[model samples]
Target: MKTIALLVVLTVVAADIEFYKTANDNYDIKALIANATELQAFLDCFQDRAPCSELTASYKKNIPEAVVQACKKCNPSQKHMFRQFLEGVKKVVPKEYNEFRQKFDPENKYFDALEKELSKF
Candidate 1:
């Protein structure tokens, strides 16, 4: 019985660690994508062209690791929202998207694999 209880606890802990903390999950990604001004702000923030909001800063901090890991820590909604945001950026502002790619993926290492994996989500 003690062994079973320990196994259960470990399983729960492992599950919790499998994804990133969800605090920012409720942020309105769709709205940000739809509003050109807001979208530009996010791009500017990430590209170091402007100051970042607390939330944007937090996201910028995690973005590289998230991309390298193929968003393994993202929950389903986050995965979907990220895909939506990427598609929106690439479609709406190709130049800025290229700039973003250059900034974040300077060596051209991660984005292709990340996008391929994200497409599966």
Candidate 2:
């Protein structure tokens, strides 16, 4: 039973890493705008009062309090995409890409570090 559970955990971790890579690979503004609807739906999962309240709660448990507080202002409404949301956070907090990733991109690897990623903009 323990072995099976370990395998399951590893599998989920691997899948998450792959997803993280794909998300970062398509992190351009144009791609974000093109997939606005889908991206909004994804962000809605983490916003307050959404269907994924439990998941949001889980994130609140893991990430820093400051990150959660900043997220309130960074909340991307129906008018935004993932990229726009990041830009908003950049405007408000200035260099919180890692904090933003903690909620949206928890895996944290597979892309540039926070400074390198932000420099591209």
Task: Give the alpha-carbon lDDT of every model.
Answer: 0.82, 0.42
Task: Give the candidate number with the greatest TM-score.
Answer: 1
Q: Can you give the TM-score per candidate against the true fold? A: 0.79, 0.26
Candidate 2 overall lDDT versus native:
0.42
Model 2 regions lying over 4 Å from their true place: 1-30, 52-85, 88-121
Residue 17 displacement in candidate 1 (angstroms): 3.2
Q: Which residue pairs collide, candidate 2?
A: none
Model 1 sits at a Cα RMSD from the real structure of 4.0
> Which candidate number would show the highest lDDT if scored against the true structure?
1
Per-residue C-alpha lDDT of model 1 across residues 1-121, encoded as one tens digit per residue: 9999999999998787666654487678778888999999999998999999987887788677778777877777777777877888999998998988788788989988878878976
Worst 10 residues of 2 by lDDT: 18-27
What is the per-residue lDDT of model 2 for residues 1-121, given as tens digits with 9 covering 90 to 100? 9999999999987666311111122334444435656434434554432454453344334223323333222222211333354565455444444445665455654333433333333
